[model samples]
Target: MAKFFKYKTTADLEAENARLNLDLRFSDDLSPLSQPVTVGTRTVGNRWCIHPMEGCDGNLDGTPGELTFRRYQRFGGGGAKLIWGEACAVNDEGRANPRQIALNPRTRDEFAKLVEQTRQAHRDSLGDDSDLLFGLQLTHSGRYSVKPIIATHDPLLDPRTVVNKATGQKVTADYPIITDDELKRLVDDYVATAKLAVEVGFDFLDVKQCHRYLLNELLGARNRPGPYGGSFENRTRLAREIFTALKAVVPSNVLLATRMNGFDSIPYHKGDNDDGQPDPWTAPLANGWGMSESDPFTPDLAEPIRWVQEMRTLGVDLVNVALGNPYAQPHFGRPFEYPPPDGYESPEHPLTGVDRHFKCAEAVQRANPGLAIVGTGYSYLQEFFPQAGAANVRDGRITFVGVGRASLAQPDWVKQLQDNGKMDRKRVCRTFSYCTALMREKNHPLGQYPTGCPPFDKEAYGEIWKEVLELKVKK
Candidate 1:
């Protein structure tokens, strides 16, 4: 296996970037990150955004459990002005896993308390909570859902959604796809969830359209028939309709947003050597959101650019640009030094993945200069993430630098930078993928383990990690 992270100094990291001819830049001046930015009618305190990192620790009734409260409380006190919350299903059947949080009248009170606690923690640490902007991400995990409600048949991804992994019983071609009438009902689900998010005191509501979920899958459903597929206008019909319906119901102060996939690269599998390799497919691939028809590996931003421009017209105030399907090509979205137990080794250098994120986000930002764009793929950079983020903000490449896995490792990273002008190297995430491993572990009575930085936040997750290790040994 390749051990890529060996940089002992900032200069060493820069040298490696230069060697790769990557456009990734860094700056010692971190003042740019501290500068406030305007989103909708609110002015976010800073550019450091704590991405919605799910713990999968919710109670069986869909309430925030003790660990869930602890996780968000840390993010509230972490000092990032924008806290993009994790995925909460709009309905029970939409949940990706048994433990995934679902929002409804039954669970609304708990959500309100979660929001209140998060804001209170921020006020205690930073002296004020008015400048902080928090959002809730709502999603329906399409093919990845527990029972697999797919948009269309995908030759590449179908095999991975196994009914029984040991028996290799996969989803068959005869399996039914979600109908247009069902999609219309799902739109209502999103609208209802948006209203609850506003009532719960969230600053914004993210209609999650990334990571090959239901809406994202519809975006690439060229083969499917009817008004919700085929043409570009038809493909985006559900999202447009949902956004329009949300605008009519939600108050003007509550912002409409989406975390969208800028590109859906082809799926990969473990080769003979246990390294990730792309599955075989012919040119002119039918199922990909922002990918070139002729070359599925490379990004074709034409549709994604047009979609963002359309979102601006439909009153979308924020857009978080993400890449790849985490389940299929994990390296594309999250460049990791080591792969998860269920995953394979990196197919290419992690630096290459980082560069792709920068270039794609740059294209989207330049196209839609009006929308507040949050760029992903920064967690793999570790210690120098702030420097790169500052440079990007200074260059007008992106408005916010989003940190996902790294936030679990150091929730107070924003405060650390404000005081010391650098991160605590000892606490910086090394991209070990332990969090991903925990997310995959479903041996518990509650159906899944809560994911966190076991290496850094040992007090909370060390014992949990031991439990996972023991479970693996027995398996």
Candidate 2:
């Protein structure tokens, strides 16, 4: 019998402290959550993956430093079947944050060390039996770059860490529109980086295709041109190109995944044109993509067997579904958007219908084999995934389900479910959205977000705590 503790109420706790003072009960009648599943030949060290959360990779001169290695290793060692090393930039201009880890050959040694630290942390803590896998969710912030020097369709993206593209110096990025050569280089960089991950000892690489990224911006009918603009095929071509390039350089042994908005299924901005671009200079700030309160634009986009089927054809191992609208923070899926006082608990929360999304993937699988779908939208509600997936698989529906935010709060979340019979039993992850505000650095991005626990970081984000205190998870 697992013990239970409830001294603290489920309130505004930080991500690190979200899962504290909890207990579990297993039942013979209630089927166990299931066991470690396979991602190809590789068995997840545990089902709960510490989903790709972002942070500076602590690079000094385009190379990772010891401090960065220690930080990630600590998180990796804390335990996870897989850990995404933030959103690594594929090329220089594609970089969003100046310190984000880049997979370029220029930083190979640092990455190699990072790989070593990941394995070392897992081996030291859990022993040889644990095969802690690592994947890189490579991204090109495109128009939504954190660097003020970089230009995009909408210029309001918080310019906290502006980067000087030429020298890679920490300068203000300007509205520098990219050219054809730059786009090709971006594709090439993705291919080269995919190869680099294998060489550096990482397991998989997720070619990021969602949010308001370079590709997304092009595909979204914003400021794009030629064949890459018109139909969905045109829009999706870049993703296919990048993935195809990755497959060529990266071996069949490596797992390739992508985090994309399965559909732009949300309502469009009323004032803006049908495309949801919003007025670049005059419209309200929230009129654009994520700026809208309407459900995520991509959620409404789930359609045509073509998009899903193509993912399978593109050598994609997995697609982590996400909302490309307001759901993605200023930097694309950072922090988190909240509604009123009690947000996560909004009656609309959790998407009243998760099965529909699974159905879309199912339709795709019929045409394309071997492509696995893993996702639960980085929610702290970890158990909801497997419990739902277990039933889905029984009905020939879902093969895998991903749990992101919860895993960050508790890395061994999967183990807890395996050891105990039920997932709801564990009492951690108040889901207070502390991690959200910290991640967003919401007070206009000048490094205002809280990183660990606010109380834990007096020097970092105590003021940010004031905003966090306003919200509650509404468990």
Candidate 3:
């Protein structure tokens, strides 16, 4: 309802933010975005980072095809120093979708070629690859998996996320909890995947722990017993073990990183009654992660600070900070004016959502200034993104400004900013979330590949959406 992009100047935006009781900042000069920063041993050329966004365009067998190659090539040539590549399942059973990319002996060599070509493209455009950092995010989809192998039977997400909108029934008839022994096997899988990444020539490997994936789910496992759940140490056991094992095998130069969820809001439903805010419970909220148990919505960064300190001690090069799961609470993660197919409306102004992200990420950065932190939620700012991003980076609030959907919408955003010193409002993302809408529709029978900006790439995704709308829901 705020319609932030309507404001033309930083002062106008600041006035609006103040009126809303929001803590936000913006700088007219965007030169801070072009400044170089170091992560562990690597010196990145700029503060812009391309956050990993998977294109469901891989081969059925999980190999990178022409579309996948083209996407990375564009990102490399797009002028972001740090390219945080999209999630690639360590194994098949853990895949979120059938088309999700996976790393293995069969696909390792091809992934290597993909990485090489992307770097070559970067070199060709930027004239230097010395400070470029490329990372591959390896993950297990967990509760949202096509397999439905979950870490814990999360009461909040179980019923809501399992049902397919089309059929109004559970996709996986049997919802099974993954055992500690299976988790140990997953550790081996991660180590194996890390080894493959090193051979494939990645600068770092992201042991992904955000967005309610298997590992992130495990972090909030307060009920499940054994070495992999219950206590805080137990909940974090998998990530700690994976890092320790991986470091021993991979060469010293290959860095380790993670994309972490700073906080999680409650799952939102689509209805007139749904305000898109957390529902009040009886005092202590159950199964909450990164939030006060007493007040499920307000952030409690104590544990998250400890988690960052632990990562720093474990020698993590950087941590890309994100918030909420796109599947359950899309608005908090990616504030959009128009929701996805089965999504709820925004409960608060998009600026409030942006403020929450900045505050949470800044908390982590303040606690561990040495740990390079990549900030999300800037894409919702539209043309004013660079101004806010520059202000935050200059103030030491975040190390890098990570752009996800905006990068997909306009690949040459950073390059244009560098050349013209201003973002083209026409090409800027309006937060319509057409990309995510396409991603959600893949659950339906007539859905096409889940990638590209439908608003921008009308020929491909928009046309497919037309056919998708004509098909009947499975139920």
Candidate 4:
């Protein structure tokens, strides 16, 4: 194992960690996130790819605008190598935020602008040798597919998660199940979006399979009887066929990967057991939908490894591993109440949380070193990421580490270590469970632009930051 060098966050190590470098400036080398890094057969530049977030910049109708123009330019210059265009809806209803960038037409100009600005800025920041790859997370919320419950299925086994509009009455679903043709259209949607991403300047694509989306639903044991349901092969058929075809269609230079969630904490799902069903694995659909799984998620490593193997055989470049998703249960480290309770994140919960994801990635690395494996999880504990990454790199355990939430608030997280030995540990975000909670809300609308953290959102975005900062008896 590489000698452990830890920090509070990348910001915690700041300039101090730079001295430990074995290879600086792989391209611009000075920049950590922008620097080229290796993954399986293909090389992934830098260590960071901005996690899809709400409204850093995008128009009201999901178009790129000055907000995104300036925002991406700011972060692009910050030296991030792989910049994913925001979580774009493959179809209209799939969008996470009404303002989220869209991959389809009518938003083409904005996307092109996004492509131009991000590329020009990155190129300018790192020079030609710096290879910053850009990608977008193609996602659909499924039951949680995003407001109005406009899912493919009827309200059979829906969670009935509501929207938080001023005129709030829970956003109940009348229709739920997706049709066979619709499923195929969903596949075509992914292909079209992939093409659009490539055209808009994104060099990579992550067909999102995480957070109980339409894709994972097919893969899950709970999927109702359909051509896509039943055996594991049937479940993964769409992902396999779609991504494989996309890999062929997109340019050879593009890096393609998928971010998926396998278990939901609720009953009939793999992660949770709230319903107390004796045969958790065989819970019948409340209406016609199937129940969640009882056993923990195993992610069928053999399946994805072979999948990655096939992709590499074709032209795909990466395989990111994951375990239970955030939207799913046990929810390991998230809050039961407000302020997130204490002792939750203190390494107590193992298989039930994001820790499981780490363990999953570590295993995937050892087994498939040739496949570029990227693993993602929470905001905290990133300071230990490099040391964790070293194990994967040196031992061929893993090739890359992804930080989702921490980087969201403090965009300059990595370089702070490379530049000044100073890491901003006093998180700009105060562990409020906004991220986890808001989505779980009853009518959480698709275009609902949540400003600031949750639970305490009313507090922080409401003025908690000002009050706390002022009251802190400064040393």
Q: Which candidate is the best by lDDT?
A: 1
Best by TM-score, which number?
1
Error of 3 at 269 (Å): 1.2
Which model, 3 or 4, shows the larger lDDT? Answer: 3
- Candidates by TM-score, descending order: 1, 3, 4, 2
Candidate 4 on 1-475: residue-level lDDT in tens?
Answer: 1122233444444333255431211111222333467643346566655655554245667787564566567567655565655567787777655556676888876788877787787667666424666667787766554464333332323443445446554445454456666777777788888888888777678877655566766666334566776666666667777777787788867777776542233322321322212123333442111123332333335544554555566555665555443433423323122222111222222212344556556666666656666665544343444444444345444455565545545555555655655345554343444444333322223334333342222432345334333434341
- Reference-based lDDT, residue 226, model 3: 92
Residue runs of model 4 more than 4 Å from their true location after superposition: 1-35, 38-42, 65-67, 123-129, 147-157, 161-176, 221-223, 262-294, 297-314, 330-354, 426-430, 434-447, 451-475
Candidate 3 deviant stretches above 4 angstroms: 1-5, 163-175, 273-283, 443-448, 459-462, 469-475
Query: Candidates' TM-scores?
Result: 0.98, 0.69, 0.94, 0.72
Local error of candidate 1 at 345, Å? 1.0
Model 2 residue runs over 4 Å out of place are: 1-46, 60-71, 129-132, 148-177, 265-305, 326-347, 350-369, 378-386, 393-396, 420-427, 442-475
Write model 1 residue lDDT over 1-475, tens digit each, in one string: 9999887776888899999988888887888998998899888999988887779999888888899999999999999999999999998888888888888899999999999999999999999998999999999998988778999888788877775655878888998899989999998899999889899999998989899999999998888899998899999999999999998998988888999999998899999998999999987677889987778888999999999999888889999999999899999999999998889999888988998999899999999886799998898888989988999999999999999999999999998987887789899999999999999998889988999999999999999999999998988
CA-RMSD of model 3: 2.4
lDDT of 4: 0.52
Error of 2 at 69 (Å): 3.9
| Residue 43 in model 2: lDDT | 67
lDDT-wise, the better of 1 and 2 is 1
Error of 3 at 52 (Å): 1.2
